[model samples]
Target: MPSHHTPYAINVRGLTKSFGGRRAVDALSFTVRPGRITGFLGPNGAGKTTTLRMLLGLVRPTSGAALIGEHRYEDLPAPARTVGALLEADGFHPGRTGRDHLRTYAPALGADDRRVDEVLAQVGLDEDAARRTVRGYSLGMRQRLGIAAALLPDPPVLICDEPTNGLDPEGIRWLRGLLRERADRGHTVLVSSHLLAEMQQIVDSVVIIDKGRVVYDGDVAAVGEPTVRVRALDGARLAAALTAAGAVVEDAGDGVLRVRAAGAEQIARTALREQIVVTELVGEEHSLEELFFSLTEPGAGQAPATIQETAQ
Candidate 1:
């Protein structure tokens, strides 16, 4: 594990990028704090990769700032020591073994062969796997090798783009644990992914974009309000009972009612009071997947205007 006396937060303010006549990222701004994992999410062509490239100083931003702490990535005294990034897994040379590839980058990061071995084991790339040529490696193996390279320097900040792309369920779990451990050590992590369900379980916060503009940026729990799901023998009667009780109820088809502004206990009591037989009653929170669709769906418009202004 690596330790940092002062961890840096990732900050982007009014960050904009345009290619040709079209805008890729428009006035995007957000902060990713140390000791937490922030999910950078969007649909295809939403400029997630563009934003990440700008953050790493790979592709220059047309306007605004992308700062790692107070300095831009290229301005960092030792960029590799400050931030380790995995932008793409296929950036490797096909003929080089994983260990050799890491060794080649070690000198620049002031790391030794021993550190390389440590990172390889950390990412579950055993010695045998490390010695094989990249061309012979599986997609999952390549992903792990990329991660190992990122961790070789034990940098305080990490940025990854779609890191779970080729991972199996078990591999995904391993990556989650690895990221959690880094954050627990007070390291900053910004990960971009389309795996909304898996992200809901791993990330502390999320920044969702649509059409290259921020739609939602906040804690995952705050994305949407919790609702109560209830099924009754008489669907019409239950709907009326819940409505009279001041709960906004919707007929969710097949005798199921989705009730908002109320809890399972309240719904149950209301049904009992009205002599309505309750067959099923469960309290559920809106899932990350649901929230993503609601914000990005056509005609969904943008999230509340205040979210873009006050997201930090």
Candidate 2:
């Protein structure tokens, strides 16, 4: 039996999964520390779902291990009590009421009927909403029900895949707060999503993958430095001058150059000194979305030429 007091950290080491001749995940490795929300991010075909399924023991890995604390998911004595996972939103029977669906799992998970009611409320599915069959529920409602089921056990580790899929703006905000609060209370949380913009607002750290491989693994804030975007009369000349002045310049098209290692004032002064007519110059913060594309987009650095076409 697993100890309740033990800290749970999701550790994936050299994890790989192959389908036929193609690899869905190749030598991927990362750690989801306790008391933090680690975003498992990638584009649509980047093996994010396959990786999460392997972590939950629904899919077997071809190599390496995905462990919570010291035990693989299947080896955990009371998995539901230790880890609550929401991998599929439409997993419930279409005829079952939301509250009844949760109640059905209660016995197997060792949770009581009261827990069903608590979780339903926690996810904002009211009594009326809970009584309706899942077939009649909207996508957002089903998403809430899935979250409610995951929360029923009040486990130490929570794993959710695309929890924000069907949420409205307000619901998305609520989920962000909920996950952050869960981690703040010392639980390990790993949430997978393909949308970089949504994950950017919540994750403490990120593990981005592409072509079934780990492209980046680190603090979200450390990927790129702040930069300034400048557009001038002679774009090539301005870029060259900025490059010579110890700034890394990237052509952003339309006569614009993204200049790093310099602020707006520095870029303005440099343009003036170089006798270049500046059209637009402003400080631009690089978003996680931008960094994600830079590392995972096709033809970009470190990404493969082939996109995953089957079973990713």
Candidate 3:
């Protein structure tokens, strides 16, 4: 088991990376705090991978800085002991057995065979599976091997890019538990993925990007407020009343109104005061997927206000 230690925070400030005339990451800025899972999300073409590479010192940024705590990746005294990353699951020699693959990195990380065996079991890779060559492993198995490698050092910070890509539901659930356990033990975790639904269940905070820039950054719960769905015979009157009462009301057609900034009780009170007939009323909270689409979809206009800004 990894010992508890103060985790290092990840910080990116105006981090930009460009290829030819195109920018992959544009002035990206966000912080991944210690002891929490921060999801780095975006659409297919968003700069998530590039930004992560820059943070790991694998890719040079066109400008700006990506740091681990107060030092850059290259400046870390013992890189493996400070940060363990699983950027690519397929980064393995085809002929190498899973155990050998881990052994190759273990020496450099000051880990022994026992540590290697521990991590292999930690990732659910049994001794039999560990003895198999990478060429014969399934995608999910490969992913587990990669995770085992990352865990070999028991680093304070973990960065996994789409770590759940090839995992089954059970595997995903196991991975979530492992990550949550790490965070609970004071390890910083940064995960980048398009699986919003799964990430919503795993991450405490989210940093959503679009077109190489941050669209939203803060607590996952703060992505959107809970909304009330109401249907009234006097739709127009109710909408007018709700709007006047400081609610943002949207027409859901068929005399139904989707409302925010007001609770069901308040809506009922307003309808009663106006003597309107109510047909249906339900409270709904926007899912992470819905929030992601709203921010990254075309014609999204300006990004919604962040939690920090809303508090001000």
Candidate 4:
């Protein structure tokens, strides 16, 4: 994780919340720094949404408080000027043109129409898109429009919940670059996504929550323990040889074996001792899905991506 500096863009202290007798957020506290992208990951029932709402003063925390920069969101001199959020991209008026939606918000932010054009162009929504009603726009277009709205005032901090929702692969790529650019401009960004495989390509760090509490909070790459997966003939004999060689080897699903204690070279040497012919020798790269499951309850699989149509 990047070293933290004081005067955080977002801070929560002893935050807690409940819904229908169940606690959704429990004494959660963290700081989000400017010029960084902190990813929020959690299971469906995790209190991520509730926590975000409380952070923005949209929902009163059952206990504790949060601040946007030095001021609580309600205490901000100008809420839109201090911070902008895209909790749900579809919250805008579907019948309104993209330009009109931004125009409605621009004046209230003490910003002019020039800022609107600048942001719209920055998000790659051209003048033609400005004239088209959002209802007629594709999901990619809507996502860009939402981002444009968040950038309307060029707030120092941004919060987005699954901003990549309904976007094509190229759209996802564009959004990643846009967020990175915002961070480079000294803007703080807190992003939430359930899709784990793609997050490493974008986020700087991660804070994972499960069952309404923090499970891990650190660099995204440091969450999981490394393991090596190997395949070879006479697998049983190879496993025995690995054990004798002081390596941790166990049966993995299918015909594969997982060895954690020793490196690939060691595993290969041990396999050769048992007259085994090695076929595949590979080290594991942690997946967001695997790390999520490890943090949460065991055996709870990832929600399969049914949104592959949008991936094109």
Candidate 5:
């Protein structure tokens, strides 16, 4: 569905932003729905940060607009009450304890102390650490604190940029689990990250931007065609069988071949006709890392990648 008419959790229409006479976001438009984790993905300079800044009302847009429900972020009387953001630049005070920092934002959003402790625990931060100064908190702990602050208001929508930065493998896994849990609870989660390998398993949908334009936006799995690996004795004989069956097979050399334009069943049927014994038949799951490269690479261009945007 079009972001213009859809009632997604987050909506942007013709959202454009500029920096130093360069278009960071150009006529960008998309929607993020509740109960799903939408990935905000792009390369290092792919306008992900600028677009997010505009959505959170941190950076004024050069043109266009974004809205959280019917209200613009800046126009909302209490932003944190409706939308929680965890941008890379946003964090707690170094001198203040993790618990105290949340307390400061709580009353501002009319949140109670009891709710504060609950959210801290929800994000896996120890409430006992409330007395400890933030200066001693590790990068992972600080991230947990940021998530706690975002959850404190019990907002329906969340916007987080590079939340797993500076985190170890374990911490990254923990953060992914937390985000998935929030989405499962009907919270709309928007996460932007350059690391596609890490984000793939969690995000339900994705909106990928490139060179100030949306390259592909769709179900992460549906972005690429299924890949298959084939192995057999007498590679040439097998390829000939596939070709005779109206399939395209390219000889990749070294007894290896790349099969396209045909599926496993067809290839198997053809191989049986030629009396070729197949050694292995496997389907390749296109990983997020591979998909990202194919979508953004030079020769691949914009044609092969398909963008599917729908609202629930």
Candidate 6:
């Protein structure tokens, strides 16, 4: 395993980008703490790719700053040693073998061929697979190879964009565990993906954006308030009872109801008092996907500039 003496968090302040008179990113700001996984989410044309490009120094910010470890990415003494990124899996030379592709960057990073081979195995691509040309690899295989390239230099910071696009269930699981373990060992990871359910399972914090602006930034758990979902024998009666008891109830159909401003106890009491049989009751916070929609959907409420500061 590789180690670094200094591991820095990502900080973007008032970042903005414009292309041909259209703003791609508008004053976006967020902080990714060290030793944690942060999920970056946005709908299409939300400027996610543009923002990431600015962060990686592939595209200059129209204004403001994007810094890693208090320094611009271009200012890093050895960028490969400071940060590793997997923006896309299609950057490979089709005719080059997977092993050869990885070897291409070894000299620049000062890594040996042995390290290239090591990373190949780390990403679950055996020597046989490595010997084959990248053009012959599946989408999933290409994704793995991209990850291997990112891990090759063992940088302290990892930024991945939609890394699970072509991964199978098992591949996704493996990638999730790999990222989790890296963060557990004090590495910083910022991942952008549309897989909200999987991200909810792993990310410690999240930054959500829409219309090229941040809609939410805080701990993943704080994204949505808690609500109790209930089901009863008489749906109409339960809905009326819950509403009469000062609880906000939504008819979710199929005899299920979504109740807010009431706990299980209050709900139970209301049901018992109404003589309505309770079939099921579950308390849960807003799922990441639901919150994502609420934040990005048209006419949705905009998140405040400062959401919340969670303890890392």
Highest-lDDT candidate = 3
> For residues 1-312, what per-residue lDDT tens digits would candidate 3 score against the true structure?
445385799999999999999999999888999889999999998989899888888999999999999888999998778899999998799999999999998988988999999999999999799999999999999999999998998999999999997999999999999999989888999999989999999999999899998888889875556888999998999999989999878887777788888999999999999999999999997778987888888998455447676433
lDDT of 4 by residue, 1-312 (tens): 122232347887788998879899988877788888989888898889999998788999888877887678988877777677888778778889999999998888866888888889998889999989889988778888888898887777889999999888888898899899878877889998888877777888777787667776666654344678888877788888888877777788587988866899888777776678989898986666776777677554323221121111
Q: List the residue pairs that clash in candidate 6.
A: none
TM-score of each: 0.82, 0.79, 0.85, 0.75, 0.78, 0.81
Reference-based lDDT, residue 43, model 6: 93
Weakest lDDT window of 10 consecutive positions for candidate 2:
303-312
Total backbone collisions for each predicted model: 0, 0, 0, 0, 0, 0
lDDT of each: 0.87, 0.84, 0.89, 0.79, 0.77, 0.87
Backbone clash total for model 3 is 0
lDDT of 1: 0.87
TM-score of 4: 0.75
Q: Candidate 3, overall lDDT?
A: 0.89
* Clashing pairs for predicted structure model 1, backbone only: none
Candidate 5 lDDT over 205-256, as tens digits, reads 8888887777777887554446457888988888877777766676656666
Q: Which stretches of candidate 5 lie over 4 Å from their true place?
A: 1-8, 89-91, 223-225, 229-263, 270-282, 298-304, 307-312
Clashing pairs in 2: none
lDDT string for model 6 (162-234, tens) is: 9998999999998999999889889999999999999998799888899889987878765555778899889
Highest-scoring model, TM-score: 3
Pairwise lDDT winner, candidates 2 and 6: 6
Ranking by TM-score: 3, 1, 6, 2, 5, 4
Instruction: Name the Cα RMSD for model 5.
Output: 6.4
How close to the true structure is residue 282 of candidate 2, measured as C-alpha lDDT?
Answer: 83
Model 1 spans > 4 angstroms off: 229-262, 266-284, 304-312
